[model samples]
Target: MKRFSLNQATTRHWPMPDLVAGCVRAGVTGVGLWRENVQEYGVERSAALVRDAGLTVTSLCRGGFFQEPTWWDENRRAIDEAAALGAGTLVLVSGGLPPGSRDIDAARAHVGTAIGTLVPYALEAGVRLAIEPLHPMFSSDRCVVSTLKQALDLAAPYPHRAVGVAIDTYHLWWDDTVWEQIARAGREQRIACFQVADWLTPLPAGVLLGRGLPGTGCVELRRFREAVDAAGYAGPIEVEVFAEDVWSRPGDEVLAEALAGYRDHVAGPG
Candidate 1:
């Protein structure tokens, strides 16, 4: 469990201080936070809360929506927030196609260029931009970058330390080529963040809150973990489920179950 981290979204309703305390009580020393939550709690105060509790902010969830007019400014502020919280990685969810537009190719190209534009700022902030390719189900409305290969390709033009791909099992486990892409990411030194969540059946209507906890669905959890490990990734394995069932329970209980899942399925007999 040394590398296990609790992604805040798994317990969305938990307050920042309570979440920090919950992590401490559960022996979880790392977390992945959302931008809105940090902002609501006061970024510096959130940073202090986590730091004083001896927990590390593994990555900040999201700073991309390239199609938006304000993307540049928004991402700059997100990078600053990440730096303030001592989070080394900023996950980018390259948004879906611009409304009513069918030009997928153009959208993707723009994302790459936008990322290129932000490379200098990211480097200056001492933050790595991690491109997270959401599942293809989200390709139409959530993320245009929907494959590990695509994410890697987008990150290729930038310095490895400046831009990289985030490997989230929930978003990528279905792709057969992911293992090889993971290897490619390693060779390129572009594997910045690794997140874990199970794929559940009868996905909820919006598909945003349907993620299962580790080992709850068909995904071969350990396979993905091993692939990332073989890809030279030795960082926090953030358990980032977004199920309402998981969130409605007590955070500590959920944390315990998440740890058990990580140990049983992801860590694998260690």
Candidate 2:
């Protein structure tokens, strides 16, 4: 059986050093990172800390807003940061149409072009870009890739080793075509990362997280696992919960719940 792990969710309360320490203490095999945390801790320092703590950096949480003119600089910088952090996968959350622009199709085109531009740099740094399709509700502002189909298209140009799509259950579980996408990802050899967090009650803010507890929420992680296993994706299945209520708890308690939840409900027998 493969192992699942907690991301920086436990370390959100502490600095990067403390967070890495917490991850080691919690017995997770891997971790995820955000740009803010990396910036605060400095890439070299954060990388050293995480390595010293003996953790795998599963992914860097972002890169891809191809919207307004300002987005170019920001996205490039994010890509640079991901490379510096030694993360193989850079989860891309594509940007929406600019203000006063009612063109979804145009925004989609921009996403394609942006990825094309970044792919060479990503390859140079040994990073694989993993396009993430947020829920449709976030189409206007957060991400233009509102479906796995769209993300797959964005990843099509590059070979699977260079480009892939992220499979986040919280974002994809609602899709009718998730199974097909998983199959396609497998066919393309592009299942970069499999992340989990269930959907809860009324979504708070609804863009970035709105994450829920596993099993308690509505997603069928067992089905997701079956699809992934069938697809031959043997990477670590990351537990990424972004609930405000959950983050408010003491770091250890939050990690305990997350780890136990994954063990009992996600990674266990279905």
Top candidate, metric lDDT? 1
Residue 5, candidate 1: alpha-carbon lDDT: 96
The residue-by-residue lDDT of candidate 2 on 13-73, one tens digit each, is: 7667766777777677688898888887788888887777778888998787778677677
Ten-residue region with minimum lDDT total, candidate 1? 201-210
Instruction: For candidate 1, report its TM-score.
Output: 0.98
Candidate 2 Cα errors over 4 Å, as ranges = 9-11, 205-209
lDDT of the structure predicted as candidate 2 = 0.81
lDDT tens digits, residue span 48-123, model 1: 9999999999999989999888999999999999999999999999998898899999999999999999999999
Clashing pairs in 1: none
Model 1 residue 189 distance off true place after TM-score fit, in angstroms: 0.6
